[model samples]
Structure formats: C-alpha cells, structure tokens
Target: MSLRIDVAGLRPERVSVAPSPLAELGMALHALAEPGHHPGLQGWVTAVTAGLDPHLADRMCEADFLWRTTFSDLFLPCAGIPGRTALPGATLADELDLLDKLTDEQFVDCALEFICAPGYDLPSAGVVSDPELRRRAFDLAATRGPRQVRFTRRLLDDPPRVRAWLRQFLRDCDEAFFADVWARVRPPLAADARLKTDLLRRKGLAETLTSVSSAVTLDEEAARITVDKLVVGRSATGDGGLLLVPTSLGWPHLMVLHRYGWQPVLHYPVGSPEPAAPPSVEQLALRMTALSHPVRMRICRMLARSAYTTTELAQVHGVSAPEISRHLTLLKKAGLVTTRRRGRYLLHQLDVAVVARLGSDFLEGILR
Candidate 1:
C-alpha cells in the first residue's frame, strides 16, 4: 500500500537530512536474518566478516527475534529508527541510552500496541475498535506468533533479570557487529547526506524529493509526499518537523517510519549505490554551491567568454573589489575557474572541462 504524508504546512526549511548508524546496523542484520527481502544485499552480507563469528552472531539478530516488520521496533524502536541523540551523530550508545530508560509498563505498552496495530494500509481493512483491538491483540500475541522479543517477555514476567540480559546482549551485538557495519556505511551515508543537503538548498524539497528515486512523489497541490511501500500507510506529522534521513544499507528502498511518539521520518537510500565513485556528494555540493549564486553565475559566464582579472570583473559590475574577488575565489575553489599570475593580478580563466563535466554527467548524478 502507499503511504501519504500531509505536507500542507511543510516547508523546505522544516525538512532536514540526517544519518543513522543504528538503522544501518539494523538493516545489515535484517539482511542477514531475512535475505529473502533484500536480495540486493546478498553480496555485501556475504562479504561482511564480523557476523561470521558463530558465537557473537547468536540468535539475537535472527529474523524472528528482530522481525523485519512489527517486532523489530522493540530493539531499534520507532520502526527501527534510533531515538534522538545529543551525541555528534547517530550512535549505538544513544540507542542503548534510550532503551535503558524504557519503563516496564512503557515497554509492554509499546510492544502490545505495535504487535496488535491493525496491519491495514487500505481503508478496506477491517476496522477494530480500541478496547476490542487491544484485547484481541493481547490474546493473539499470547499465541498468534512466537514471542520474538524474548527479553521483553521476561521484562513482564520477571522484571529484574531481563535488564541485564538485554544490556549485555545489546552491548555485545553492537561491539561485534554494528560497529564494523557503521564504519563501512558512514562514508556513503555522509555522501548521501551531502547530496540531499545540496538538493535541499539549491532545488528545495520538491526537486529534492524527485531525485530520491521514482518511488517517492510530492504532490505540491495537496502538500503530501506519497511513498510506495509494502505495508506503510498514511501518517500525519506532529509539531516536530519531518526528518529525511538517508542510508547506505537499504540501498534501493524508501522507508517511511513513525519515530515513536515524535515526528515521522522518511528514510531512504542516496542516489548512487556505488559510494566510491568520483565527484563524491560532498565535492558535488561544493561545486554546486559555488555556482548557485546569481553573481557567481555571471562571473562564470563572463569568464567562459574570456579571461578577466578580478579587478576587471569588478569594474564591469561596479561592485566592491572585495565582493567580486569573493565570488571569483569560490569559483576557483570549485575548480570551475583557473587563475594564473599575469604580471600584477591573477587572470581567471574558465575551466571548460569542469563546467562541461558538471553540466553533463555530474548533472545527471545530481538528479540520480
């Protein structure tokens, strides 16, 4: 079913792009646990060395324990999206910190609510009232599927020991697997962030949403973003602004998840699956930013026609010498223009190759 996001009051300034090592780790584990869902990840999963260890790779990360859908929220929470962190970036510690504070009642409430929530994406799905829904859900969860979150069961049955098991299991799993997965995933995640940040700035969310692949669409009239997903449905955001987070792990799919009692997050992959390619997102961002301004665009055009000293370019515009120089410096920094000392001042010449590259293939990459 399709997920509809109400963006009626949304603005580009309200949207932000972020990275999540925790979600990436969850994805890696999910791929391992349910290779059937993500056939594309098979190659990378086979190549990962950390989870190869039999002992450390215990049943903790199995497909059942961390169910691909409903139950996975227990470990990663909020559709496996990590909670907000005061840390510099997404971290395992932050996830653990949030989990550590989960009260017994809170834990049970979350587990039951998600496990019992109607798996209905369409209006056609049968509607069940709240009282009957929870009662039926609890009854079904008692026998519907095997208990996936084993620790949580103990949490309700015998609260004391579950904490220790959970703490140790989480720490050991993070150390043995997530740490390595995050290290490998960070560069691409950073690149994706750069690409989105550039798109958000230059093109704004409408254009940026288009580049996030065809599966995501923005209806400007309705101010809604529709995402095609397996079971995802409509969700309205709260006061917290919509968060757009990119990932390297789920390279091909767009994930629309509720961030647990907070704002909703639209998590999806960056344009390129190949992260090591030249003109990385950050590089592209710098170049695009350098060329974005009206004055800078004029400078590039003027320089393209003929070489000119910073003073000469300044004279044409009749602006301050310092301002013209600033624009010229940005262009040079992006390698879009070259400078050489011609007697007294530097003569800036348009770097035809850089412009052509950015205009053609680089432009396609940005759109991708």
Candidate 2:
C-alpha cells in the first residue's frame, strides 16, 4: 500500500521553547557521537547536572556514553553519510547538505521514526511527499531489509508508543553487554583515582549513590552495573566530586531520576538562572527571534562545525560579503558566535555553549 506521511505531524518541540525529551536525547546522542568540542552537548550536560548530585551525575555520564555508543552502532548506520545520495565517500559538507535540505519537521519525524522502529529500520519509505521520492525511500529501505520496512511502518503509526517501547527496550539490553563494556572502560576511568577518593571522602560513596538513586529507580542490576562500571578501583577526594566524562546517554538517567521523584540541585553559571526557577519567557522569544531570520540561522549552522572567513561564509552561503558581514555582526552581538583574525581574514565559530544554555532555558520554560 502506498503511503504519504506528512512530516508536519512529527513536529518536535522548538529548542527555544521547551526542551522535548526527544531533543534531550538528540543532544545527548550528538555529544556521544562527537565527543569533544561540541559545546551544545556540554551545555546540556551542565544543565542536567545542575539538578543532579555531582557524583551520581558523573557516573551517569560515564554510563551514558556506553549506551550511546551501543545505540549508534546498532542503528543509524547512515549517521556518517552527509547527503541524500549516501555517496560511498561523501565529505562532511556533503552530509551536512543532506541535513540542511531536511526541514526541522522532516528531521524530527525521521528521528521519531528511527527511535520507534526496531533496529536499523529506515522510515524514509513512507515519508516521501512525492512519488519519485517515495520510490527512492522505499528502494533504500528494501535494500536494507524486511525488518526495516516493518519497523518503519510501526513508527509511522504511533511514535509515542515506540518511545515508550524504547524505555523498556533499554531496560532489557543484556546485562552482560554492559558488564563487558564496563570492563573495557574501567581502567581509563580509574587513571585518576585520587579524584574519586576525594569525592568519596567528602560525600561518601553510599550517600552520593543513594542521593542520586532516590531520584531514579534504576533496576538493581543496572545500578550495580553502573557502580561497578564507573567506581571500581577509583578513589574519591575530600569534596566528594569527581570529574567523570559526560555523554548523551546520561540525560536518560536524569530523566529516569526525575521520574522517580527526586529533586536534584542544579548549579548554573553566574549569569544563568538556577534550574529550579522557571525558564524566562523572554529567553524563548530571543531564540525564536534569532531563528526568524533564515539567512542568519543558516550562517550560524554553517559556522557551528568550524570557523569560516567572511569571504568563505559568503561563498558557502551564496551571499555577498557585505550581507554576510551584516549577519555575522548581528550574530556576534547576540552572543551566538565569535570571530578571530586569521591571516588578514576573519573566522567564525558557533557559540554552542550559549546555544545550549538558550535551548535548555527555553525548553525548561515550555515543559514547566
């Protein structure tokens, strides 16, 4: 049967309005996929930590990376592919172009479909608005497998149900898988044992874990696995805070904690608000305002990966240097980006940290 899925129904909550669980997941996964220098992910980690016990949050971050890695490896093989064609050796720009062509609505729909479907099922089949596009999506899914087709259909029918299924699905991931993965990761995590010892000395391991556990009812095995995975052979410091690598998967643990009814104490930077305070409506307005200008937003997205010269930005965006400069100036003023002098040229990079904070604040307001 032929189907035409309206990408509109899959609308994700605006990043500037309220944070959707899906957006949280996306941010987390994005962080796990690209470990360092993604300020957007770091901002998320910081926001989540604001409401969590420092030690527990740290552990959750460690565990989250493992989960994220497994999830990515299992699904979304096309993640590395940049564009519509999925060329054999596509450049990052090519992949980004594919991403760029996708409307926010289309991208969210695909993400919902991906999470809802069983492993590696492509939902592109039912999403094509045109007959030709439908055929191509179908062809791609078919080449992958029957499972992909079936899963995509399920995703098209009801995404929330699929998301619920995923929670349970994660609960059921083999205990051994986590155990083995932990064994592989434990050594490096332990390399800085003194920090762990200091954290324990300050708060005590049991108290820290208990405080965090109160917020989320982790399965006994899951909790044990996490402790074993992260704390084994590690020493704590006097302050009871240890620096643990953060990951996208950690957000789920935070969600799970929130679900269990524990209130975490969030710490924000000097200029930011406390996590407990309602997100300012004005912040949301600012983000929406920022996104309202398509050309400017596009410029922001392009600069997100790396800095670009004014001339280079103009060429990539198909605009004049004067126009590009105008937009860049506005972006800089908004604290959305920064520029540096490079060999008589200016380069720009996305102020991801600011974006993350803006995103977190906006979402928190809406969700509340």
Candidate 3:
C-alpha cells in the first residue's frame, strides 16, 4: 500500500528560529550578485524579483554572494571549495558543467583520502582481488561492527575506487537495477518520506524545482508536491514513492522519487536548509556536561561505532562493568544512546540521528 503526508503541516511543534529576515535578504542579494549562491534561492528570487530593475538586480546579486560566503563560513565550515562566480556572462549550463567537474570521482577520491584516512582500516588500491584485503575488511568490520562498516567488503574493498566504480555502474544500469542499488546505498533516505516532505516544506516548490532542474532535469518539486497531496495514511505512504534530493548545496541536487517504478525523479534545487530540531534545556545540559568528562566522551565514540553490552563496553574501555554502566546511564539520560535488552544482556547503541541534530544545534549556538 502507498501513503503520503503534507510535510508543511507536519512540521515539528517545537518552534525554532526561522532563518532571520536579514539572513534571507542577505542570501537574496548574494544570489543576484554571484548567481552561484542563488542555487537555493533560485526560483524564489526569480519569482520575487520579477519586475526589479536589471542594474539593481545586479547589485543585489553581489550582496547575496558576500552573504553566502559569510554564512557558509559560519554554518558549513567544512563545505567543499566554493565554485567560481556565476554572473551575467555565465549561463546556468556553464555553471552546471563546472559543478559536475567539481564533484567528479577524482575530487571525491581526494576528499575521501583526506577526511577518511585516519578512520580507514582497510587497505587501499586493488583490494578487490586480494585475499588479504578481504581478511582485513572482515576483521575491521567485526572489530568495529556493522554501524561503522555499513557496506560489505565486496562493496567497499577500496572505498574511493568502489564509490567511483559504483557511480559509473549506476549510470550504465537500467532503472530497476539503479533502484535496487540506491535502496542498498541510501536506505535511510529511501525509507523516510518525512525527510523528503520536510525538505520540500522548508524549501518551497519553485526554489526546489529550479535547483534540481539545474542538475538532473526532472521536475521533482511538482512530483513531490503532487505526492504530498495524494499519499494516504502514514503507514501506507511507506511504499508511496522515493525521491532523492541533492546531497549538498550545489547545482545537481539529484532528486529521485519512487512513484511505483524504479525510475528516478531528478531535480536541481538552489539550496536546502538543514532539517533539525531544537534540544531541550535538559538535553543541552546533558550534552555539555558529558563533554567535560573525557571518559564519557570516549565511551560515546565507542557507542557510535557499535552497540555493546555494559560488560563489553567495560572490557573495551578497560574499566569495570559498573563504571561503564554509570557512564551509560548518564548517556541514556542525555538521549545520546539507547538500550535494548537481549536476554540477560542490555545492548547500548548511539542514537545517531538525534546526535547529529543535537550536534548541529550545539554548534550553531556556539557559533552564534
């Protein structure tokens, strides 16, 4: 059965600050100036600025770019290189070609090598054919467990190479195969209709469509809105459709929705605001207080990698079981970890989604 819900109406009840008017205006000005930053602001700006003077538009665009630079530095400190200015002389097609080249396999490889080298346990290069590679992959996976090594060794023998190979493979595959592969790779995005709805709700139809159209050329905004209005109960919507929005704030925001078939619904949207929820004072206090203790933080990191019983955690941390349990209690109270009873043993695992939201909130507070 298929189901759907309008996300705009389902927004979390706890109100957080909307992006400030100044921020919005600044973003608009940047969109007019650089054109690149406007990816998120695209259709909305076009819709809003329909009758403005051309020269005034140009000035606003420059201001928009400046704000984009400032906001990015503050909010997305780890954002990849900002692309070249897309101005009057540059066409959207040209900017897109540049974006494609920017995030190509070579660049992705470089990024993986840089960011993942410290945490990477498996060997690099042609590990696909080597028995040693398979052994190491299994050992690494077993030691670190499922959460850390989400993909099988066969799928991740050489992380960078595998990702690149898979990208090309998907490009060549038929729709059915693509859908299967996508499900395996991004089950969270696939399973959660709320993620799609929230994105569309936060970024209205026009802007979402403009950004996505720049990349994949499909009209995802319309499809998503249509689905939102059509899908039935929440449970039924689970099978309704699958739409993959862009991964980041660039030209090709790949928007794919599952509308019964394996075909992808692609789009290019200007930008998307991070989906988040505000932490309660108790939650905030817990996270902040927990960070003050190195032992607790280390325990949190271990839990992030995999679930462990109190005894297992104690063994891994080289501490007594009671000590581990005490820390675990604090973590559980903070909503950073969850516990499930497995016979006589209680297994503890990180609450990743909640942790991510909390982390974002904490950072935003610190930065502000």
- What are the per-model numbers of colliding residue pairs? 0, 20, 28
The model with the greatest lDDT is: 1
lDDT of 3 at 234: 28
Whole-structure CA lDDT of model 1? 0.62
lDDT of 1 by residue, 95-196 (tens): 666565655544454444444554433221221224554455556556645563443344445543655665576677677666877887788777877888
TM-score (all chains, Cα) for each model: 0.59, 0.25, 0.30
Over the full model, what C-alpha lDDT does candidate 3 score relative to the true structure? 0.40
Model 3, residue 235: distance off in Å is 43
Candidate ranking (lDDT, best to worst)? 1, 3, 2
Using TM-score, give the best candidate's number: 1
Give lDDT: candidate 3, residue 273.
49
- Evaluated at residue 115, the lDDT of candidate 3 is 18
Of the two candidates 1 and 3, the one with more favorable lDDT, higher being better, is: 1
- Winner by TM-score between candidate 2 and candidate 1: 1
For model 2, the stretches where C-alpha displacement exceeds 4 angstroms are 1-284, 365-368
Candidate 3, residues 1-368, lDDT tens digits: the string is 12232223222221111111112222333344445443554774565457555654453332132243322111111112232111110222232233244333223222233112212222223344557754665565556445334444424444555445433322332131223323332343222334444555686443443333321222334332332111122211122222233222222112222222121222222234423234533456677786578988888898899888988888888999988888888888887889999898889999888777775555433321
Ranking by TM-score: 1, 3, 2
Residue 120 alpha-carbon offset, candidate 3, angstroms: 51
